[model samples]
Target: MEGFPEKGIKMGNMTIKDIAKKCGVGVSTVSRAMNNHPDINPKTKELIMKTIEEFNYVPNNSARNLKRIQSKAIAVLVKGIGNTFFSDIVSGLERECQKKNYSCILQHVEEQEDELDIALHIIKEKKLQGLIFLGGSFSHPKEKMEQLEVPYVLSTIRTAGENCEQYAAVSVDDFKESYKMTEYLLQLGHERIAILTAPKEDESIGKLRLMGYAQALKDKKIPVQEELIGYMDAKKDRYSFQTGYKLTKELLKKTDFTALYATSDTLAIGACRALKEAGISVPDECSVAGFDGMEAGEFYIPSITTIRQPVEKIAKATAELLFDMIKGKEVPRQLVFEGELLERESTAFSSCHESVK
Candidate 1:
């Protein structure tokens, strides 16, 4: 057999022709061996492998992906990776993908409108087998995805004004969970409860959670006070600890609410800080609660009371649904998961009656 070149050149510059020459085999034989072709003899494949190692040959992703036809790789596109909620969803999706001997590719759009177009372009050009939209709103033309015949699922969040019946989704019953949490607060004798949320139309979560809050208060024979409700722009800034802090401060100034329910955990944490700094004790002077049971909530100075969504379960169910769709099996179009209320130090019965005395 021929010998490999000296180990001076970069591996990226190494090509199949170089490997074929060094192995004393045809380019086709080297190609077959690299791709694990059945026609190649074991001994010859073994010889090619040795030469490939010596030369440090690296396969070209673009060319190899084209020849494979089916990548056996799924793309998971989300709004942000830093969010704990999305991270749990990804962990769940990864578990199912690994079981089926498939790979998962994560992509984040950061809520930019143009990124959706780029994602659609990549799907069509790459011929990806499947796509999982984890979060964020995808408003691009659906005709492209439909024409490519690619199976796609929306997880954690659903597309508004789209025919959801035509696709599959895994999401929590936000409206129900929000309503339940509000009802719990009201049951504790909090008629002046405040709702802190982002804009309604931009995110379905905001709209649903706010509706639940309103419904619960109305059902309890309590008047819905406009001043007690807070709204912020969901797309204005990244959902961070600071956003929660600022919004909470504003809400506290706008209303004298005896209880506050933030739509997200981050917001709730911020609200807690603002309340403390303002000389108001949580669950005593004013009760506080939030959605999304983030890990940080457990260690918070006074652990936060919040709602917990089964993020892992949702991810696993989404992956299973996608797998079924790939195998031509008809699965349910929509799967709704329930939320659990985590009771902690941040919330308690209203102190309004005691203050009156």
Candidate 2:
């Protein structure tokens, strides 16, 4: 090094040679001191470390992690990050990941197809350790996930198809939950119970939920009326309040149902609004209930009776499954949770008829 300093190598703005000269030591001594070598004096090592900090020395994370061979970041892909349902799940996921010293990166792919593409890209490019698929169904075929060879967990409200055995999933027993809700309404002396649900045959959950509604009526010896069933495509709006509002308005004009079981809280809330505006009393003129005990449902005028899914538990279980898969542990292919019915002011005895007019 021309005069041992002209090379311009610096540590904390002081050239390595300058540090060595200042400590009355050789360049080897300075290097050892900076690296905290056992041969270096404690005072020298402290001075070197302090100088590095004072000068705002930055280490390259990529280079550092290259030595570790693995990243601690996990990727989360969902339909919409703004949705409260997804937010609650994310909260649970973050809690679990934090405890395990892993960072979570959330990505919202509005389209299902796009989400599949991104998930594949993340596995190949970002080298993500694991992925958590939240809310919506995967657009790609189940085989694609197996082909990509990545650890993933699905936390959608619905269960996956038969081909989705490679990944783990957490979902509620939609059929049993919906059937129980319908049975409860029927037990309350409701004969004309209507179901607002997404199209059947789209997935097991949707079809099973609708089946439960139909079965409950059939079990009680009530004839199944095709007119009482409202079908929407979850792939299409998935039962928004506006969807509920419009559908209920139409249903009221077409049929006189005594009770309504909406597939989602948003739909039920919309239904309630439409009924109130039409001078129809809730639980009196029409007993209303919904799935997914969302917080907004509780504060709605008269509140909403709903089947409450264990969203947090689902999230936690989903994360744990993915974590196990990431660590090369075998997990169950399907994990199903039960839902609880939260009876509230929105539902009442069939005889409690208080006219709004």
Q: Return the TM-score for each candidate structure.
A: 0.76, 0.76
Error of 1 at 203 (Å): 4.7
* Span of ten consecutive residues with least summed lDDT in model 1: 1-10
Tell me the whole-model lDDT of each prediction, alpha carbons only.
0.77, 0.75
Residue 274, model 1: lDDT of 88
Model 1 Cα lDDT, one tens digit per residue, 263-299: 8887788888888889999888888888888888878
lDDT string for model 2 (52-112, tens) is: 4554444333554662335677888877454566677888898999978777888877733
Clashes of each: 0, 0
Q: Candidate 1: misplaced stretches above 4 Å?
A: 1-69, 137-148, 160-162, 354-357
Name the regions of candidate 2 deviating beyond 4 angstroms.
1-61, 67-70, 80-82, 111-114, 137-140, 164-166, 233-236, 352-357
Clashing pairs in 2: none
Give the lDDT of residue 150 in candidate 2.
71
Give the lowest summed-lDDT range of ten residues in model 2: 1-10
